[model samples]
Target chain A: MATVEYRNITKRFESFEVMRDLSLSIADGEFAVLLGASGCGKTTLLRMTAGLETVTAGDLLIDGLRVNEVPPRDRDIAMVFQNYALYPTMTVAENIAFSLEIRRVPKAERRRRAEEAAALVGLGEHLARYPRELSGGQRQRVAMARAMVREAKVFLFDEPLSNLDAKLRAQMRFEIRQLHDRLGTTTIYVTHDQIEAMTMADKIVLMRGGTIEQVGTPDELYDRPVSRFAADFIGSPAMNFVEGTVEANGNAPAFVAEGIHLALPVSLTVAPGSPVVCGIRPPDLVLNADGSIEGRLVLAEKTGPDVQLHLSVAGQDFIATASRDAAVEAGGLVRLSVAPDKLHLFDPQSGRRL
Target chain B: MTVHSASRRRLRIVAAWSVVALFVFPLYYWITTAFKNARDIFDQPPSVWAFDPTLKNFEEVFGISLGFLRQQEVLPGGGNFYMAPRLWDSIVVAFGSTVLSVTLATLAAYALSRFPFRGRHAFVAWVLSTRMMPPVAVAIPLFFIYKDVGLLDTYAGVILIHAVMNLPLAVLLMKSFFDDVPKEIDESAIIDGASRWLIFRRVVLPMAKGGIAATAVLCFIFSWTEFVFVLTLTQTGLKTVPVVSSSFVTSTGTAWGNMAALGVAAMVPAFVFILLVQKQLVRGLTLGSLKQ
Candidate 1:
């Protein structure tokens, strides 16, 4: 395992810049995730670290050694691509043993190591099978096994789990986490899926427009996102934002929209009647017996476990998660009370948290 | 009893059978004619089966004296003949040309398929344009150049011309095959510690076996039957089987029996060649190109 440092790495494709001034350090054996939407330079950053892509200008150091000019293989990094990139012509055994074979490992040792790697990924029975014969999950496991046999200093994953189904993805996610824990290899996983980042990463690096937006633990990002993008992107049924003015009545501040007013925490220091965006998680807004903010239910989606209601008030729509017992139908009036501490306030024009 | 469904099924069956019959009938005719003597060949009503079959044609051609000794007919009466040395020369030239052309073209094709460089589109267009020209158009100029360069009446001249003529087609076909190999595989190999050459040999070439076989079959067939270039470029020393077969067509008594024997002999190598790579040919033709 090794620590990787990307210092002011910038990548340009002709005139368009894919990544710019990106700098971050992944500590030894840390499960770090680079998270962003598609075309947001997460994959580009990962490839740059793998030395598969040239850095237009910057320094990439692995284990405190400058490897800016070192090729991927010499840098001792193994990458599991999104499609798995298993050699379709090779069987499971050969696919896993390819890196070792290139490194000139003896036949007996290669076979022994390949079988062990296959068993680690629960693929011991599939040594003779070709990649085409394996299912999607099995193919992904073979890709992981291929990387494992290399025993490289750094492991890079470029959205490896995005191709599997929901259940299989979750299952594989656990297997990958367990494997990482067992192997203790420094891993850099890139994914656009927030859930994968949240569930898999020890430290999550949120990126937007080729720059690091925020870097923190999953809880830290969820609890206190530095920007509106982070707050909205980090959660499912994302935090609803209402554009309104913040009104301070003595010590308590209230956020006023067209037809609703939500009280804010005393920690928010916005001037009276200053334009602000109020952020609230769907689950945090409780459907109470008596409450202040009122709206008519626009739509409700029942997920069997819980029902999510889309409440429309004052030209803004708010999402509220409630139990299945609360049968709020469309066009029905609903009242929700917001806990003041759970509320997030942002500057309206800049989207920066206040 | 839907009229549309019934008619569509009927149309499809008719179209499919028509294609099969169109291809099968010519080969059936060639095989039957290969067995016939001079009179049986031009029978007003062509017979599908030979009334009397004989192995006289094969024996006569194989036993023809090169006039080194007193002329002795290998059969009761002379039917066909071939000088052993010249027949071997034709085989050598055809196989040599195919091997050289296909190997060089494979390298060129791989480069065109992978690299993004300046003037790439122009280079591809230029290669394709070479194939558009009629072989006969360059025949006169090539003959003169070969004579001036002391390449006249030699196997080297014939092989070089064949390689040049077939290079465009081979490059186009092999390039399409190489394009089907994913660029991601190359990148993955690079990250796994493989150099560019290593990636080509270990990853790209193995995947392109089907296409390589298909290209080899096509190049062999083209060089095997190429008459115009062999006729014009080389006079005495480098004549191929096609030119030799055409020599049997004299103005006086036509040597139909000898021609049929020679035709059969020429067809054997091509038949064996196709049989060896028939799987690739069927797949290549049906698929239009390799799957990516």
Candidate 2:
């Protein structure tokens, strides 16, 4: 296991800059995920760490050694690609033993270690099968076994589970996390799926436009987002935003929109009448008989355990997850209550939390 | 299923057979001519069938008549009709050229496929453009060069020209085949501690094996049938089947039977090569499609 650090990494393709001044650190044995949408340079960052892509203007360190000029073969890392990339010409056993073969490991020992890695991924019975003969999940397992057999210093995953089905994705997520816990290899997984980031990362590095938006524990990002983008990107059903202005109701601060009013905490010292945006998560809003915030119900979507209440408050669309038993109608008034401090205030112009 | 559809299907089957017959009739006539006597070859209303078959032409061309059949005469080009050494020359030239062309093309094509060099597309187009020139124009210049180098009538001289002639087409085909294999497999191998050369040899090359076989077959066929370079460059030291086939048309009445006999004999090696790699030719075309 080794620490991976990117210092002032910049990437450009013929002057079209994809990243600028991007820096982050992944600690030894830490499962840090690079989370972002497509074309956000998350994959590029992961590739640079893997030595597949060059860092245009930065120093990349593995175990504190500068690797900007190192070739990928000498970097002591293993990767699982988005498509599983199992060598089509080889059987599972041969694919797993490829690293050992390249390093001149003994034939008997290579077979033994290959079997061990295959057993770890539940692919022991498929050692002789070619990749084309296997199902998607089995092919993914072979890919994992290939990576695991190397016992390299770092493990990089480029959205390895993105090609699997929904149910298989969840299972692979749990298995991958368990494997990391057991081996404790420094891993940098790039993915666009927030659920994978939140569920598997010890540290989630949320990137936007090639810059680090936030880097912290998943809970830290979800519980106390530092920006409006972070709050919306990290949650299910997304955070609801209602544009308005801050006003003072006596000593208590309140967010006043066109047809709605939300009381804010007294300690929120926004210049009494400045423009602001109020954000709250769907689950944080409770359906009650008495509430200070009122909205017109647009639609009620039932998702078995809970219903996502689609409401229009102050002519702004919002969603609140309420229990299925809550009496809600499509075209009726819905009163939603939220703790005063549960609401987040952001600067309307910069989208920064206030 | 329906009456009209059944009749239409029958009509299509007949049409396909007619086209196939148009293709195969040359082979049928050539093989029959190899066994026909000289008079029968030039018979009025040329004998498609019912002609008495003889091994006299084969004996005249191969210089080896079975004891049962022994009717022969002086060859039009020379005193004796022995031409086995010429067939040997053709074999060496075609096989040697195929090996040389395939080896050079594979390495060049791999670099073309993977490297991000400036003007790469233009370079590929330039390579293909060399093939558009008429072979005779290149052949005359090559003859003068071979004379200076003292390579005329040598197997190496002929093999070199054939290989050079085949290179442009071979490289283009091999490049397309290399492009079919996914680039991710190479990256995965590299990250697993494999050097670039190792990834190419152990991984990518095997994946493109079928494509290589297909390419080798094409090169072999081209070298086998080539005519102008051999005719322009060689004196009496060596001659390939195509050039030597013309020798049968000297002062004597055209030896159609002898020429047809050589044609029939020449088809064996090329036919055997196709039979050997036909499976790979089919597989290579479809190999890269499954991965992604």
Candidate 3:
């Protein structure tokens, strides 16, 4: 396993800078995920590490060695492309054994290792099948097997499960985590899906507009996001945001918006009369009889285990999740309270967390 | 409803057959004329079915007069009707040029498909523009060059020119085939520790087999039928079928039967080549329509 470091890396496409002065250090054997929306430079970052794209400025180091000019073959890294990229003409065993064959491994040993890799992916029976003959999930497994058999110092995955169906995507996500756990190979996986990052990453590097917005554990990102974008991106049903002014109410801070006044944590400090955006996760909002905030429920959707409430509060839309057993109705007035600690405060002008 | 649909299907079949027959009519007439005597060929109102078929034309064109058969009277120029060596020359030049052109085009095309060099579009346009020059215009300059190089009537000279003539079309066709292959495959191969050429040979080339076969067939057919360069550059040392067929038009009159005989014989090699690659040709034609 190897640690990958990008020191002040910047990528520009003919003056249109895609990644700007980005620095990240991935620990050896760490499953680091580069997570962001499309055009956020997450894939570009992964491709840089894979040696498919050149770093326009600064240095890229693998295991503390400067590898700026190293070709992909010399980088000792294996990549699983989004399309699975299996050689269409090669059978599953041959595909898995390609790296070994390139190294001029003995035929008997190549076959043995290929079968072992295939069995690791639960594809032992598919050894003789070509990629075109396999289904999407099977082809994905073949690509994984191909990467695994290389036993490289680093593994790069470029949105590898994005093409699979929802059910298959979840299954493969879990399998990938399990594979990483077993191998402990340094991996950098790029994806726009927050759930995959949350469930699989040891550290999630959230990116926006070609720069790092937050790099932390999933819980840290969800609980203490550095920016409003991070707060909005991490949680399902999305975090609710209310534009308001922070005011002093007998030393305890209060967030006041149109037709609403919510108490802030006593220890929280912000300048009085300063505009800020307050964020609260869906599950943290509780419905109580004597809650401080009142809103008219606009829609209620029961998604299996939870009922999602879309409420209109102070002329702004907010979402809150409750148990499936919760009795909520559309067009009904409801009182909601947020736990003070769960509330996130951000500067209104810059969207930076305060 | 059943009767109406069945009749509609029958009508479609008839229309398809009529179209195919329309195309095959000229070839049928040409082949039949190769076996007819001069009297039968110019019969009043034309004899479409009934004719005294003869092998005299073939015997003259092939320089083979069969034993135990009454030999037909030869033309005034007697031995000039013998064209077997010219037929051999056509086969050699076609096969040689096809092999040469396909190899060069495939390599050039793979580079064009993968590499992002400056002015790549302009380079491709320049390569294609070489073909825009009219054959007559190119043949005169080529004749002088061939004479200077002492390649005036050599097989190598003809093959080289034909290969050069076919390069533009071959390269364009092969490049499209390479483009149909996803670039990810090459990247994946690179990450697997294979070099650029290894990835091309083992992965990209195998996938583009159908396209290569199709390109080779087209090159072969074009070389087989080329006329201008062969006529302008060569003497009697070597002659292709298209140029040699003109020799039949002596000072007296055009020897139509002998020319038709040569034309009919020339079609066999090209037809056999197409038949051999017919499966790949169909597949290559529709290659880019489906995503792998």
- Which residue window of length 10 is worst by lDDT in model 3 chain A? A129-138
DockQ of prediction 2 = 0.50
TM-score winner between 1 and 2, please give it.
2
Candidate 1's TM-score: 0.91
Per-residue alpha-carbon lDDT of candidate 1 for residues B1-292, written as tens digits (9 for 90 to 100) = 7999999999999999999999999776765665676578778787766545544444455555434464556433343335432566567777888899889988999999998899998999999999999999989998889889999889999988888899999999999988877776777788878888888888778778788889998899898888999899777676788887787666665556566666777778788877987876554321211112
Q: Interface RMSDs of all predictions?
A: 5.3, 2.6, 3.6
Number of the candidate with higher DockQ, 1 or 3: 3
- Model 2 chain B weakest 10-residue run by lDDT: B283-292
For model 3, name the residue pairs that clash: none
What does candidate 3 score on TM? 0.95
**Candidate 2 per-residue C-alpha lDDT over B1-292 given as tens digits, one digit per residue, 9 for 90 to 100:** 9999999999999999999999999899999999998788888999998799887777778877655655456665566655653688888999999999999999999999998899999999999999999998888888889999999989999999899999999999999998987788888888888877888898888888888898899999998889899999899888999998988886656888888989998999888888988887777432321335
Model 1, position A17, has a per-residue lDDT of: 90
Checking candidate 2 for backbone clashes, the offending pairs are none
Kindly report, for each predicted structure in the order presented, the TM-score of its chain A compared with the true chain A.
Answer: 0.97, 0.98, 0.99
Give the Å error, residue B93, model 1: 2.8
* Two-chain DockQ for each candidate model: 0.38, 0.50, 0.49
Expressed as tens digits, the lDDT of each residue in B152-175 for candidate 3 is 999999999999999999999999
lDDT of 1 by residue, A81-118 (tens): 88887777778999899888888999999999999999
Q: Which lDDT tens digits does candidate 2 get at residues A1-354?
A: 899998999998878999999988899999999999899999999898888888899899999999999999888889999988788888899999998998999999999999999999999999998888888888888898999999989999999988889999999999999999999999999999999999999999999998999999999999888899988899999999888899997898888888778888889889989999889999999987788778899999999999999998877888999999998889999888889889988898898899
Best by DockQ: 2
